[model samples]
Target chain A: MTVDSRSEKTRPDRAAATRDRILDAAERLFAERGVLAVSNRQIGEAAGQGNNSVVGYHFGGRSELVLAILRRHAVAVEQLRTDLLTRVHPGSALHDWVGCLVRPLPAHLAELGDQSWHARFLAQASNEPTLRAVIRADAKASPSLRRAQEGMFRLLPAVPAEVRAERGEMSRLVVVHMCAEYERALQNGVAPPSRTWETAAARLVDAVVGLWLAPVTPAVLGPDAALRCRR
Target chain B: MTVDSRSEKTRPDRAAATRDRILDAAERLFAERGVLAVSNRQIGEAAGQGNNSVVGYHFGGRSELVLAILRRHAVAVEQLRTDLLTRVHPGSALHDWVGCLVRPLPAHLAELGDQSWHARFLAQASNEPTLRAVIRADAKASPSLRRAQEGMFRLLPAVPAEVRAERGEMSRLVVVHMCAEYERALQNGVAPPSRTWETAAARLVDAVVGLWLAPVTPAVLGPDAALRCRR
Candidate 1:
């Protein structure tokens, strides 16, 4: 091959590797600290990039950088969700569908092993307003996630739509924060409550099922009745 | 009184006001941004302190500042908890005990009116390692909180202690993050899932009661059986 062709052939590969390094560094820093806490300069230094502006050059801005990190993990997690979805059928119980929603991320983290930072990074991202919208939009784009959500909701016909939406948010918070806590525990050399991610996820699935199945109390509006509502 | 005596008396009042300003500014910034994401310099500026060292001068470090803000809100929340606990008796139902655990913060926030940031601030603090420890220790110190916890656990006689602990964490995560989300939604001019904090707390109490009552699935260890466990 010509020298120009040889250089051209390696260019994309080199660029991909550089992008991966930056994403890894950014994810770790964002997870360890906070999403808005860490800066591009620190990310560049952690990634071993000579140019401080390399992050900006590659990712454009903070939201784009966060989206890139999320998309990187989402591909693997999305595949896990799809795999789980195949096992779920029309006759599946609520727990099975909930597993489709809950297990993918933990299962993905399990595959990533001890070095994974995706859970913590996503947990931090979920707290930031702008990044939260980004995550919601991204999750909405995932057909597998939507399917799992729909399947879980299908089993809860007795639940009001508004209550389901609220419980959905609760389930997301529990799963995301709990997984992040588990990851943090492992990294800190602290013994997590569960022996394995599998066990933790199982426990989470149980609590979430309970959360979804909980009875809703109707709101009683008015000042005089507000005091008596607690009883 | 003489001019000197009057000036001396006002000095202490002025110092208290300054500290309150710093605490208010720090809490809002930490809530809007992440805890570690914000700097003392930013906090001081937000507080309208001309000197950059004002935050450090008032509060020795970041943890101290966070603790100060927490303690400021805790006094009010603790009082609300105590008041709620008075209404909860040994004969009270599971929901009553759960209400004791869940309602105080939301009640306190409700009293704080539309401008409250404690929920979001505490939510952010709960995510940070050192701050999470600080929060746990603080909560453990509250007599009313311990009483409420014991009351709730008493009703769940069948749940394994490990599972109880796990659910307890889940309850805390759900309450903290859900309240935070509500606060954020209110601030963003969006309609929250629940019409009022009172109703939100009611929903949380219901879910937490269900969570504590969830059936535990036994963990089956071993690589060969692991894949089959999900099925």
Candidate 2:
């Protein structure tokens, strides 16, 4: 019933480092092999630990390890959300908001941000059921995420609670798809005709913005209105 | 290297029950564990085939097995889409299209549709990378899907290619969120508050459609006036 003394014996600084290493290794492997395919032993080995005990020692188990990885990165992810909200003007084009949301990752990768791998891994985890709960829980618990949501709620006063939740879900998906696709593009070395990472980011932002900003006008309801006929 | 005799042995009459068994097991497992996590042997065993070769003999392999499940439920899925599209009156509401796309799974389950599990599995696969390609390839090969796409293209003629693609991606994420939430709800046996599912679906569709159908009344801006918003 007591906390594991074996885990507590390690110095706090060293323990933190080991935990980071395990998380780093785990995210990379999860990104490459998926949550189910990656084993605790493999994660420990990747972290330079001698045995599978690290997974249990540092975290309770594989599931907990996944949560830790997500928890660690939830800060950066939430900050990205805040950054977008800050950039939106009351009258700004909807796409501008979309651009603000979509443009960050490649921009970071180009600048060589420390958490690029973690970002990519988190994006992948967004869809994974075994790992998705961890990501959602971490995201929900993030102060930055809370602040961002609050800001969005303030900006979208007219949007219903249910609508806000739905919009939030779409926002998450847009980020996941953009990040995952960007990573795949890098892996394939297919420099999208855009030429620069920033350019690629801009294109993504444009496409996202166009989709989000394009349909805000009130529609005259009719049998075929759902089909989105041209104005 | 050679085509297996099993392929020849799978005449339409003998294959119906076997194919259904394969699909039922594959869809359930894929929903529980992704395509990579569910092995051929596991699928064969679950399908009640004595030999592990049933997956290959019946559906090619793991990837093909995933595609087979998609194809098996293609009719039901498409019917759902058509039903939703038809529900939108001339202009009754465009935002409902988003709900139409997402709400039907729960409705299908409520109605005791035969392929509800497969729909849930496909919803999960929509967010997965390994299965995305398989599903996309199958969609490309499916005449019904192409016909549906053409039908949509004709209706939304003003939607740019890139915009269409982005919306499609966004739609996938919407489905993923709904499916993931539904799965958790089912696991917990919690019925979301009445109107919760429909409300959530409507809210998401509003954001998606709002951004796409933004009402910019193009005032007969002499070319110069029209150019004002270009930047």
Candidate 3:
């Protein structure tokens, strides 16, 4: 009765807080165990919810739950990219824009400090067809990401659409899996090849920039390739 | 008495055949579902074994089962890599040596024709930390892979060890994930980015070669990287 008289706006903030707690617990468990292995009941318990079904109630299912986690990070990651965009000049080198693409992730993870699992969680999701779609769709919504991509592409040679798409996929694989491996390595007391997250990001930036700058070789189109996309 | 003699000699062959059937079913199911989602009983039934426990009886558990699947493919892929090495002279270009590393995979998949699950199975395994170790250990055992690594390394710039290791990981992620995507795409009637298997392999080779050739950025080694190796 007293709550009914209070501001309804405060309720939304409480709901948001509950949502954050569920996502946090879900990401950590999913990262430590396999994604499919951890159940929503476990997530609810970890989130300190009394009801075991709270994760499902709040997020619907695993896919939505996963998306919520991706989205929670996407906003912050996009913000980092947006902040970095302010430093970019019109004629910056390809590597500079590339840095804009790669740096935001590690920088954000560093901000998360020791308890980071987003990168590992993401890497695990990348291998699953459905989960990977959620990530791709979320990434496609980033205005700053699209800007960095266009800026980088403008500096490179006009690659065939197929090659362009292929490289883009490669870029994703490298970033997610490398970070996953590095994060896992640090957690296991096995030293990561690159010392700091900053240096790891640096190495990743250099390799990715190189990937973009590499020349494309004309493939001898077999019947299938020719049928799919004739030059 | 005659039946006893025949059963003893043929028992080994029958067990071998059952192992092959189990591997085939396990790979197919694992590729279609996920590594953790499928059960040993389902695998046994799929393999046509009447005994529900035959999968566990034959292969021990999921890790061993996954390893058996990997080992089955490793020999043929390694053989192809070995065959390719004859053409790689000491002065071969970095791209040529890179071919030795990348081509064997798609080439082997093409050999399997329409029904191949190795790539997808590998992609799924890559998500699970334990399963991935089995794949990595199997790859490590191949003499040709070692030779290819050494050969590729010789043609490239002397990158810092951490950077070199980092890029090597990047190379693996791009190869496995892209091939997995391509395989799944082909299976589902979704046109792959590069149409044919050969063309897809060609694009991958070109990109990885570029990655290896990318200039190494000097790392600002934090204490961990510095301790691992000094410049």
Clash pairs (backbone) in predicted model 1: A37-B37
CA deviation > 4 Å runs, candidate 1: A1-3, A192-194, A225-231, B1-3, B192-194
Q: Which ranges of candidate 3 are over 4 A from the true structure?
A: A1-14, A192-194, A222-231, B192-194, B221-231
List the lowest-lDDT window of 10 residues for candidate 3 chain B: B222-231
- A85-170 per-residue lDDT for model 1 (tens digits): 99999789898999999988888887787898889998898888799889889999999999998898888757766677788888
lDDT string for model 1 (B1-231, tens) is 457888889999999999999999989998988899888899889989999988899899888888899889888888888888889888899889999999888888877877988899988888898998888888999998999998887887677667777788889999999899888787777965447878778888889888887777787466744574344
Quality of model 2 by C-alpha lDDT: 0.59
Ranking 1 against 3 by lDDT, winner: 1
Of the candidates numbered 2 and 3, which has the greater lDDT value?
3
Residues B181-218, candidate 2, lDDT per residue (tens digit)? Answer: 65556555663444333333444455555445433222
Residue-wise C-alpha lDDT for candidate 2, range A1-231, written one tens digit per residue: 899887788778788999899888988887765576677888899999997688888898766877887667455545555566675665665445554455445544544433356545766566566576766776677664565344434444364444445455666666666666666666667634433444445545544443433333232345543332211
Error of 1 at B174 (Å): 0.9
Distance (Å) between predicted and true CA of A219, model 2? 17
TM-score of each: 0.95, 0.72, 0.90
B34-99, model 3: which lDDT tens digit per residue?
A: 688688988998999999889888889789999889888887888888887888888988877898
Which of the two candidates, 1 or 2, achieves a greater TM-score against the reference?
1
